[model samples]
Target: MRNLHKIKLLYEKYLNRTATHEEVEELFMLLRDRNQFQHIHNIMEDEWERNDIDFSVENLSWEKVRSEWPTEQKISDVREMPIEKHAIWSLKIRKIVAVAAGVLIAGMMLWWWTKTNTKEYRTGFGETMEIVLSDGSRVLLNANSKMTWNTNWQNIQERTVQLEGEAFFEVSHQRMPVNNSSPDQKDSISLMPFQVITSDLSVNVLGTSFNVASRRQKTDVFLKSGEVLLVAKPPLPRSKNDEKKTAGPSLAKHMDSIYLTPGDHITYSGITRALERHEEKLPDEPTSWVDGFLVYENEKLETVLQELKDIYGKSFIMEDSTMLSRQVDLGLPYEDWYTVSELMSLSLEIEMEENNSEITVKKLEK
Candidate 1:
């Protein structure tokens, strides 16, 4: 309320030709703020009514101005130019100012609304988070991960989200009306595809539970239950014509796509841009990490150490190069990091010394 009063005072001073140069600039800066749209509109409407400006015929409201506003233009560039005192009371001048103010506010509103609607979720190293999206879907974000999505899902055709690092998704089913259907089939509703996009691949699913990890220039997807489709994105085009051709469905259709069933795992290397599939039986409960436990069997020692580093924010150093070839079969709880370290040392038959966040491994003397 106080801000509205101040804006009205500055506007009145501007019209009376009593405002200094700095005051005129301050009034414009305040008017450019999107949050003050309603206040500015109210002030302008009151001014127009007093000046006997006919708005009824034109149906000029803030919404109409906003819809017709140019998006690419900046409102800050619209400054109040100095005019003669004789021109201050001109009815034509008053109407021009009113229209210009509405357009300026609309431009700022478009940019500000977009920024406020997109949401981001992130986790720090050694931290994990569980997010319940607006669509009733659930995401278990692992350590050092980020996910972004548009919160306005009702207006979106596709349920899409971008992921970086690792996360487990349990997507909810959404039945939306099929578009471009025949008149008789207009009432038909179909399952909407939920997409999790990474740098190199897009995982499309219709209500499924799976884990996705994209890090170190590689992407790994492990299906826990339900179906998933992996679509490899096309490489960047070298020319404008190539870019246009790739934008067509023909190019995207030719891109590699693989289907996954439960217990299936696929690894995509960003360097080679090739996918390698593994069909062996996964160790007991591959997603046990989501329950605060790291469970793996016959996994390389180096892989286990890397998982440890991600969870505990620790660095592992192997004094003996042969340790890299060792395999680990273990299930350790997240809360018991020290005990897990001790158990790993005993199982590997190596001397493990920890100093701060670095762990040094040496061959134990027999």
Candidate 2:
């Protein structure tokens, strides 16, 4: 019974967002211990079903509890329970059950609160979304992207998020007011960097706008405005047994980062461990898709064809590899497939024909 009271206190602390990290971790560990919490969870579920409480809003936060308590009191006023003297034989059993029920209710409240309060946003294929955060920072999520953060953003020491796929952020410059408990008295707003972590690299910035492409196979970063730092993962250490078998002298240290100025793009290839940077020239067109345009300049014919297939669902076949290698410098508007094909043909001096909806390009023999 004493242990049950301690658990209830910890749960209340968690709901109030006042629990330490260690305490939160301990609470989750206890919840996941099926042998300990399974019976409690089942009992709580039944109790919740019988009560006419609105579980959806109640599960999201403790703020609703204060608002709903008054209404619940009004409802309870109409019901009356008969008082009975406790029988000696069943008194101990009743006390034990009451304590167990209290513990169970607290556990269920904590579980539901955690599950519903966490903020998560995701975009599906060919879908884009814009998010305005509580801090006034704006995020533009590209196709097939996901972003998530904790709900206790106002109380947390730092604002952070986990992101996948691609996004462009315009972060607000206003610094959040720090609590008195914070150890650092000096304002470290610049030092507190925002991070976009991919599978192989992490991009850190204080306040900047940049594009991040972090698909499984390819990871890329393009800095449009302000400064950003890139950190690549260190190579894994070889095992003792395999060290002798592999006879490649000592491995050279890989270049983890190459800082980018505005209009600079860096691509990190995991298979090659090579970090390549290309200067952004005229027709800066990589992120044009966000603006509803496909602008390609001096792009290879094959590369442009692949882009067309991805966006317009149009496949192509090149009879001659040499012809396909011809680089074309053109900007095809992203309105329709026919317009794009006409623009490409006009720029490249080629004949484009659609046979069963598959585009075929042929160089004019002249």
Q: Can you list the residue pairs that collide in candidate 1?
A: none
Per-residue lDDT for 231-332 in model 1, tens only?
777532234433422233433654655667788787887567766666544542557879988887787888888877766778988898788878778777
Best by lDDT: 1
lDDT of each: 0.74, 0.62
* Model 2, TM vs. native: 0.55
Q: List the RMSD of every prediction in angstroms.
A: 10.5, 14.4
Please state the error at residue 127 of candidate 2 in Å: 5.2
Query: Model 2, stretches more than 4 Å misplaced?
Result: 1-127, 144-155, 158-164, 177-192, 235-258, 309-315, 336-338, 349-366
Top-scoring candidate (TM-score): 1
**Candidate 2 clash pair list:** none
